[model samples]
Target: MTRAEEQRDAGLLDAFAGHLALQRGLSEHTVRAYCGDVLTLLALLPHGPDGNAPADLGALTLATLRRWLAQESGRGLARATLARRVAAVRCFTAWAQRTGRIATDPGGRLLSPGPDATVPQVLTAEEAAAVMDTAREQAAAAGTPAARARATRDWAVLELLYATGVRVAELVGADVGDVNLAERLLRVLGKGDKERMVPFGRPASDAVEQWLAARHHLLPQQTSDPGALFLGARGGRLGARQVRDLVHRSTALAGVRDLAPHGLRHSVATHLLDGGSDLRSVQEVLGHASLSTTQRYTHVSTERLRSAFTQAHPRA
Candidate 1:
């Protein structure tokens, strides 16, 4: 493509990203993923008006979309990755059509392989308890006030994560005012800017309260209120990566498998299902858009029951 064409493409891509973020209300992580996929597609395709490939949405075609997927498949991309690319293209095409930038959506017929049916890793109730208890013990053993405050923060992070199953992004994005300690509930802004109130048990409430008491210790020297529920050692808002590391460190200390924040979410959903919480309620708690997405946890719950039954059964 000419320099002018490349610049135009970049501008259009930026506009699309802005739409995804401000208008569609996608999370930052998701918006980044979608934009990355689209950028990759643009790079792979031929550029310029005379080229067979499209340089803009108006010139895009179903064949071009299929060729893009074919090239990705030839490059040995995973099925899930290909599926996501197809979705990204479709979303962009739909938006372009809606906004009158394109006469028709070229990705209307685009298709990719379905996702694998692999189960997500989750922690057992015992494992979850052990991790929390270990963090609590560490907090109790801390020597300095700063160390104790961080330990207390870690305890609350794990407790709230397990108790409410909020995403790491949601947890880190939370502000102090969002928590309702009196009611044992906290407001979380979930995907697509949808807000939901999640309730936590007394244990989580107590942990949060303890952290709040010492929260001032972690405050930056100048800033009176950082406004973030969690904070880093330097007193700025705690990032998602830091929260993930905290979860990993806590689990390792407890001698469990290395699990991410999402693992806690999976664990909570599975445990809820195992304890007879209905699928719909789990769906609501997790903010899943579809029941089918929530139903995957049933496999984990069912396997646990099957194992229990097999162990106790008289005749095999």
Candidate 2:
């Protein structure tokens, strides 16, 4: 592509990113992924008459869209990746057509493989309790003020993760004001910037209160984001990566199968369903956009039930 063509594509991507962020309310990570997919699709388009520049949006036909997906499949991309790419192109084409850049939305007719059906890994309720207990034990054993603060924060993190089933992003993104300790509720901004109130248990609330008491130990002289509900060693807002590391470390200490923060989310959802929480209620707490997404926990519950039956049934 010529320099001018490359700049044009860059400008298009910039505009599309704004649309995804401001209009669609997608998260920054998702905006980047969608933009990257669209960029790849644009690069794969047939050359224009100049034979150097890539074809314009006008060339985004259904055939070209399908060809892009076929090429990605050939590259051995996962089904979920392909599906996201399809969504990206469709979003792009619809925007292009609306803005008069393209006469038609070719991506409208395109299709891709569905998301993978593999079940997520989760800890049993007993295992979850063990993880929380381990975190509390670590806090109690800490000898120094800084160590105690960090350990207390980790305990709070694990308790909140299991109690609310909030995504790691949501937990890390929360502020001090977002928590209602007295009411045992947390306000989180979920994917798509959707806000929801999730109720946690007393254990989580008490852990958070303990961490709050010790929070100043980690506060740096020049702290960043002092209002953050959770703080790192440097006194900045807690990050998703830090939360993930804590989850892994705590699980290992608990002598359980190590899982990421997301696995903890899965474990909470499964436990809730197992304990007789309705699907709609779980959906609301988890901030799932679709009820169908919440239904996956039901499958996990069923699998557990089946395993127990096979192990204990006399008929077998």
Candidate 3:
């Protein structure tokens, strides 16, 4: 529409962001991410698109794009981050083609970044318990000694995430009314706003009930309420930032140096598989839109075989 990244209309990025917001109903965060991803590619362009090369939107080639990605790798961007950038580029070019800005996407044949294949990091069981304990103490010190009750809430959130392997975004998006405590199920709202109801074990159920009984202390109203299962101190509703900050701060206090918000979700799936839960079951609990995404949790094949050989062979 604007002459193929021609005039550097400064408003182009904002326009795309607005389009994402209005047309896709994407969250502000997502719109920004998409825009950022596209801008990153534009920055990598030689002499830019409109003004310079127009053959392929500034004659950007697959090799050129790969070089940009390689530069990103050299700069020490994490594999996951680089992968996201690739995906972002792909999405942007697709959008460009769809919107008729470019006849063909330069990113169409671009290869995905290599995956790091590092077993995703996570908190050990004891470490997770310690983090929960720390959060409880903080909540208690903040006001009432409602620590156990508060801890009950954190534990439910932590355990359910770990046990069910759902994303923090999904967990925070859960609603009080959506959770069927009697049935031990929580309806998780996922990306693209897809919904699924996942069942949890008794420990998670007990913790959730404790939180529910004390829920009024956290959320004082239900009429026209936000209906979120989790709440922040100010008490509107909890957000992913709050959840990540909660985990980060609590784990730091407990000295679990490598914990992350998604770590608990990773731990859940890995633990389930370790405890002999089938891969399909783990995949479903994780709400992985695909099975391949869930397979990363199967960190046992090589390690397990080594352990079996070492134990059974006379070499040891």
State the TM-score for model 3.
0.80
CA deviation > 4 Å runs, candidate 1:
1-8, 49-54, 74-78
Clashes of 2: 0
Q: Give one digit per residue, the lDDT tens place, for model 3 in 213-308.
A: 776676545534576787766466777787777677667788886677787788777677766788888777877878877787676444665788
Q: Which ranges in model 3 have alpha carbons more than 4 Å from their true place?
A: 1-10, 14-31, 45-64, 129-151, 220-224, 252-257, 301-305, 312-316
Q: For each candidate, what is the lDDT?
A: 0.87, 0.88, 0.71
- Per-residue alpha-carbon lDDT of candidate 2 for residues 280-303, written as tens digits (9 for 90 to 100): 999998989899888877888888
- TM-score of every prediction relative to native: 0.91, 0.90, 0.80
Model 2: CA > 4 A from native: 1-8, 46-55
Q: Please report the TM-score between candidate 2 and the true structure.
A: 0.90
Sorted on lDDT, best first, the list reads 2, 1, 3
Q: Which window of 10 residues has the lowest lDDT sum in candidate 2?
A: 46-55
Q: Which candidate tops lDDT?
A: 2
